[model samples]
Target: MSAEIAPQPLLQVNNIEVVYDHVILVLKGVSLQVNHGSIVALLGANGAGKSTTLKAISNLLRAERGDVTKGSITFEGRQIGKSDAPQLVRRGIIQVMEGRRCFEHLSVEEDLMTGAYTRRDGRAAIKQDLEMVFNYFPRLTTRKSTKTGYISGGEQQMVAIGRALMARPKLMLLDEPSMGLAPQLVEEIFQIIVRLNREENVSILLAEQNVNRALKVADFAYILENGRVVLDGDAETIRKNEDVREFYLGLTEIGKKSYRDVKHYRRRKRWLA
Candidate 1:
């Protein structure tokens, strides 16, 4: 029998550095990969360059006067360092940005239709995909005609995800899908994220802070501090790591710390050494 060849990852971000203007370094030597049919989580604090990394991949950094100063990002076999955002979107990479940025004036269905704007596929295919989104987010079915701003926060988050689904993405960059929602809604969103990966075969690169929730859905995880990847491993292993359990998960040998204490406690990360 012949030796089988291992396949390359669906997306690869290699030792990338990002900067705003000609100064202000953001990401430094940060590299990670998302394999086909897998979810990879980028776990970090607020200023840890998580969003900057996603914006770099989606080529959205330029809008904010940011640029990838070093290294490269590739999707499949293509080097996409200079590719425009629309080009990436057409190439089947979609980014659902944080804060549920829906078209508030537009109806829920209309907001979703915008995702297919780059598609050359016929209207029939588009309509079918719209229904597919609806199937995945049944809550949006009744709210289809409602303006996005009029819906509840949870419903708007659903619209944001549904809109991305309409793009028929090969890979989805989800930035904090659980941000600012109630605990119950956060659980629901992550459940749908898993279904999208397993059932629809969409690979995910998620930038998140909710380590506990993110670990439940991620296959692999990379922890970021400042502008660098400090540690990475399989999600199960990360969940049990003593450092992770203490700093991010609020678990200590003493006991679980309250959110107030955990947030205030200075993070003495050994990973930085």
Candidate 2:
């Protein structure tokens, strides 16, 4: 008889619930998993418990008067809810939060170095890692000495991502990396994430409101509505689904056209008049 093999999950959240001040319940029973070297997208509307899930995993839910009332979050086959943020970082699970919360007063290089605080490795190794981060984000290297507050929003976002990379994470929890950025910048950031997953083999658990673009890049996807996973499947399948198209992606049968078409139509109407 062949030995039965157990499927290994890099991170797992089974029936987790979080509440704020014992009054407002945020996450009802959210659950998902990320395997090795795969991108999983958690898609939903605003306040749909996407960020809440990331916070729950990182033990940062406390700041918002929140606590996980039920269930467990395991990372690398070990339960981690009791571990502090620094401990979690040491375990190689890092989160680039919703806001690109770099220290405004600090230089860009200094902000990235903060992620390496948990490391006790030799200075040469640290320097090498720093160089690697810069290689991935050369724009940051050019402005390494500048205060983070003065950089563009997109650059600050890069600093946030680079800082997380400095931790040498086995898994990355990214919350809304494309938010509030221009269309060009959003594309740039998504490309960087795709490269990170493909080139570096970094397992990513991405919680994003930009459903269309996320589904395009993710290997697998989970749709969270009202704190429950209403849909789960391969990314391409979900992208083609009618329900997903209407609710999340907002893609209509007419198809998406560039903004230039609308302007051209307006000009034609004025000329006809």
In terms of lDDT, the best-performing candidate is 1
lDDT (tens digit, per residue) of candidate 1 on 1-273 = 001232888889999999999799999889998888898999998999999999999999999999999999999978999899999999999999999999999999999999998999999999999999999988889998999999998998899998988889999999999999999999999999999999999999999999999998899999988998988998999999987888888778877768676656545453432
Cα-based lDDT at residue 5, candidate 1: 30
Candidate 1 has a TM-score of 0.93
Per-residue C-alpha lDDT of model 2 across residues 16-123, encoded as one tens digit per residue? 999989888888888888888788999988887899999999887878889999999999899998988889989989999998998999999999999888988878
Off by over 4 Å in 2: 1-6, 253-273
The residue-level lDDT of candidate 1 at 11 comes to 89
The estimated TM-scores of all candidates read 0.93, 0.89
Span of 10 residues, lowest total lDDT, candidate 1: 1-10
Candidate 1 steric clashes: 0
lDDT of each: 0.90, 0.86
